[model samples]
Target: MTDFPQKARAAEAAMRAVFDATPLMRNDHLSGLHGADIWLKREDLTPVRSYKIRGAFNAMRKVLDADPSQDVFVCASAGNHAQGVAWNCRHFGTRGVIFMPVTTPQQKIDKTRMFGGDHVEVRLVGDYFDQTLAAAQDHCAEVGAHFLSPFDDEDVIEGQASVAVEMLAQMDGAPDVVILPVGGGGLSAGVLSYFRDVSPETEFWFVEPEGGASLTAALAAGAPVTLPKVDTFVDGASVARIGARTFARLSGVPRERVLLAPEDRICVTILSVLNVEGIVLEPAGALAVDVLEALRPQIAGKRVVCVTSGGNFDFERLPEVKERAQRFAGLKKYFLLRLPQRPGALRDFLDMLGPDDDIARFEYLKKSARNFGTVLIGIETKDAAAFPALFAKMDAAGFAYRDITSDETVAEFVL
Candidate 1:
C-alpha cells in the first residue's frame, strides 16, 4: 500500500473517536438537474462545523505524542481554522493561543471561544490576516509554543486526508469525480493525496472563488505567488497565496482542472442551500456546489462528490448575502435615469413597468438641467427577461439611463 494511503487509513481510524464521518448525501435536486449522481460530502457538519478540525486534531495529536510536554499550540485564523484549533485544544486538554484578524466578526470569535473554552486564548491582532499571522508566529516563537500551520504542515495534511478516507468508505468505494474547494490547499492537497493512492480511479476538479484563486495563480506560475489583492467576501477561502507545503502536493493538478466560481454565483448557491434545503452555508463553503453548471456535461452519468467545506455562517451577514444573490440572479438592478422636468414624465415611465416589476428605490440626483433631472432608481423584477422589454420601452420613449448594478463604485456609494 502507498504510504499516503496508509496514513489516510490511520487518520480515518483515529477520527472515529471524535465524530462519525459526515454524511455523503446524494442530492436529488442536483442529480436531476445535472443528470448525474451528485453527492455532497458534508464536511460542513464536522464537530467544529468545518473540516479544519481534522487537520487541527491530527497535527496537535502528533506533536503531543512526540513530546508529551508540548502543551502550548498557536495558530492564526479568522474563522473555521480558529474554531478547529480551539476545539482540538479542548479535546487534548492543551492550551492554544489563536490569533485572528481584528476585523473578524463577533459571531466567529464567540464560536471560537465556545469551542476552545478554557483551553484556548483568543487574540485579535492586525486588521489583515497576513499581519495577524506574523504576530501569531512571533508570539509562538517568543513563548516557545508549537506553531500549528492551519494547512501547510505534514501532520495537518494527514488529518485533512481523513476526508477522502471517509469519502471512499461512505461511497462504498471511490467516486468517479471528486469536486473539492481550494483555499490554502491543505484540505484539497491531503484529500487528493489519499485518493491518489487508495482510489486512483478518482478524477479531481478544484474550485476557488474567482476573486481569490491563489491555486490557479500558483498553477499558472509553476510556483506559489501572492495575489496583489483578494476579495474577502468569501472569508473562509479568500486566501492571497497557496500554502507552500500544500501547493507542493497540489502542483501536479492540471491547470484546467482548477476552476474559479464567480463570487456572486457562490452567493446564489449559499441562498439556494439555505432557503431551499434549510442548509446554512458560508460563501466559501458553497463554491463546489456553484460549479455544478460547469461540470454538468462531464459529470453526467458519473458519481461526483462535492465537498461542502464549512458552515460557520453568521446570520448578521444574511442581508448582504441575499442582496448579492439577487443581483447575481438578475432579479435586481440599479440605474441612473434622466427624467424630463415635465410633470407627466415620471408618470409615463411608471406606466411602462411590467406587471412583475417593482420600484425598490427612486431618488432624484440632480435638478440643475433645464429640461431633465438625474434620477437614481432600483428595480426588482420576477424575471430577468423583463429588463430587455423595459429597456426597449425606455429607448422608444427617449429616456437616458446608465445601468450601474455591476459597477463596484456605484454599488458601494449609491446602491
Candidate 2:
C-alpha cells in the first residue's frame, strides 16, 4: 500500500504515450455563482471524452506487457467504458469483444465501433446491463479471454489514480475541497486512495444521481447491496450496486459527504452550462457541478475542484433535457382540464391566462352530451408564481382542472 502512489505516478507517466493530461482550469462562471474558487478538471475533454480511457489504457498496457502473446480482451459497458476499451484495443492491436445492453443508444454503439475499427466486435445482448454482463462473462470463459471489470480490477483503479496525480501536479497545492461524480466508484475510489496518501488534509465530496444512489445505499448497509431498480437517465453514473472492491476503499465516507443530484435538477445544470459557458456535458458529467449550489455555504471563499466526468452526450436528447430542466424549474406544467362544451370555452380559458403564460399544447379528448369536455393542455410561463394567480382565476370562473405534471401514470400515457 505504501508503494501505491509510486505505481500511480508511473501509470500517469505512461499515459503520455497516449494522450496529454486533461486541463485543470479555474471556471470563472461557476466561481461567481458559488462565490468560491471553482476549478474544473476536464476529464470530458479526453480522447474518449471521459476518464474511463485512463483505466482502460493502464489495465490493457499492463496485461500486454506481462503476456505479450495475449490477444483478446472482453468488456461489458453501456457507453463510455466500452469506448475507452475499444480505443485502447485499437492502440494495442488486440481483438476486443464488447457487449452492451440492447437498449443502448445507437449513437454510443456507432461511436464504440468507430473507435475500435477492425480491432473490436460489438455484441448487443440482454435488455438490462446485468444480463449483458452475465453474457459477457460467459463468453469470456468459453473463449478463455480476459474479462475486464470496469471498476473492480486493481490495474483499472491504479490507472484511474492518474487523474489525481495530474491534478495535484497541475495545481499550486491540494484544493480545500474536491467533488467527484460516482457511478460504480472506480474514479472516486482511485482518486480518494491516492489523495489520502499524499494530501491527507484535503476534503472530499462524492455526488451520485438521486435515481441511483449506490454509494449511499452501501454506506447505510455497511456493504455493497444491489438496488432493485436504477434509473438509466444518467447512464454514465447509474450503477445498481457499488463495486465490491470500490466499496472497500470508500466505506469510510460519511453519509453527509455523499450528495445526491436529482435527475431533473441535473438537467438544469446541463443546459445552464451549455448555454452560458458553451460547454456540453452529459447527465452524469454534470453531477459534481450540479451540487455546488447545495454546498455553497461550505465551499464559498474556498478553492474547490469539480470533475466533469464525460461529454459524450447525444444531441438527439437535447429536447428531453430542455423539457426536464423546465419541469424541474417549475417553468412548465401539464394539466387536464374539464371544460364546458359550449362555444368560446377555450377563448374564456385563454383570457384567464396571464400575459406571460403561453399554451404549448391544447387538445380536446371528447365532447359529451353532459355539456363538458376533457382537454389536455401544456402551459409554459416565465415565472412559477404565475401558476397561483392562474389557478385563482380558474376557480373564480368555475373551471375545473387537474395538474398532471407530477402524476407519473398519466404522464407516461399522455405526455
Candidate 3:
C-alpha cells in the first residue's frame, strides 16, 4: 500500500522539476488584525499565478513517464486550470487542446495562449461551462487524447497534496488553524487529506463564495449536489458543483467548519489587500482572507495559515471591484425617484443633499406625464448610517424614491 503522506512528499519532490515551492510567508498585518500568528501560503506566486499548475504538472508528469509517446492532452477551463495545462504542455513538449466558454475574458484567453505558446490550441466553445466540458470530453474521445479532470481524478488529487507537504516543511511551528478556499475542492481535499495524516492537530476552516457554496450544499445533502446558479464574479472558485472525488475526502468534515463568503464582501477584501498591503488578489483568491474576521475568535492567540490561492487578476475589473467594495461598505447606493417635471425640481432635490452626500449619477428616464418624471439617481455618502438620515429628510420633504441598489433587475439594467 502506498503511504499517502510519503506519496505526497514524493510528489513535492517531483514538482521541483516544474516550479519551486510557493512561499509560505508570515502576514504581520493579518496577525495584528486577528490577534494571532497568521501566515499566507502564496500559491499566487507560481508560474501560472495559481496552484492549479501543481496538479496539472504532477498528473502530466506521471502520464508522460509511463508512456513517453502519449503527448496529447485535453482540458476545459475558463481560467487558471487552462493556463496550468497550457504551461505544462509547453514545458513537457506535448500538444494540448483547451476548451473554454465563449464568455471567458479576453485577458484570460490571451494568458493561456501565451503560456502554451505553440503547444496548445485553445477552442472557444459554448456560452456555458457544461457545454464546453462536454465538447472537450467528446473531442478527447475522438482524438485519442487524455482528458485532464480539474479535480476529480485520483492523480490530480495526489498532485494537489504537494501543497500540504510544502506547508508542513515551510512553517516554523505547527499551525493551530489552516484556512482554505474551495471551488471544485481540489486544493482543499488534497491539503486536508495530507494534514489528516501528518498534522492532525491543525484545525481546518473551509470557505466558499456564497453564490457558489457547492461544498456547503454538498455537506447539507451528504452527497455532491449542484448549485442552481453561481455568481461568476468570483470566477476562480465559483464552481456550480463540487467534484465527487474531492467530496469523498471532504464528506466527513463538519458542516460548520465550512463558511460562505458573500460575493461583494470578497470584493472588499480584494480592494483592502490591494490598497493596504499592495497584494493584488482575485476575488476567489481573497476567499480565505475575507472570512478571517468571522473566525477571529477561534484563531485569536493561535497560529493560523490562510492560503491566498491565486492572483490572476485583470486590471480591467478594477472598476467593478471598487464599485462592489463601495456598495458592500455602504458607501454607495442607487435609487429611482419620482421627480416633478417642473424646471426647478432638479434644483430642489440637489438642495436637499447633505455636506457629505454627493450625487454620483443622475438621469431622467422618462417624462411621459407632464406632472412627473421617472429619474435614476446614484448617491455616495461618507458613512452607511448617513443613509437613514438622508432617507428621512427625503421622506419628510415628500420626495418619492425607491432604493434600487439591492434590486437585481433594475441594478443590472441601470446601475
lDDT tens string, model 2, 235-334?
A: 9999999999999999999999999999999999999999998988999999999999999999989999999999999999999999999999999999
Badly placed stretches (over 4 Å) of model 1 are: 367-370
**Can you write out model 3's per-residue Cα lDDT over 1-415, one digit (the tens) per residue?**
3487887788889889889999999888989998999999999899999989988988998899899999899999999999999999999999999999999999999999999999999999999999999999999999899999988877788898898899988977678899999999999999999999888889999999999999999999999998999998899999999999999999999999999999989989999899888988888789999999999898889989899999999999999888888899999999999987788888888888889998889888894657888889989898898888888878998889999888898788887
Error of 3 at 110 (Å): 1.1
Clashing pairs in 3: none
Per-residue alpha-carbon lDDT of model 1 for 120-232, expressed as tens digits? Answer: 99999999888999999999879999999888899999999998888878767678999999999999999998887777889999999999999999999999999999999
TM-score quality measure for candidate 1: 0.97
- Give per-residue lDDT, candidate 1, residue 387: 94
Residue-pair clash count for candidate 3: 0
What's the true lDDT of residue 160 in model 1? 93
lDDT of each: 0.90, 0.94, 0.91
Candidate No. with top lDDT: 2
Residue pairs whose backbone atoms clash in candidate 2:
none
Query: Once model 3 is optimally superposed onto the true structure by TM-score, how far is the C-alpha of residue 257 displaced, in angstroms?
Result: 0.5
lDDT of 3 at 59: 90
Q: How accurate is candidate 3 locally (lDDT)?
A: 0.91
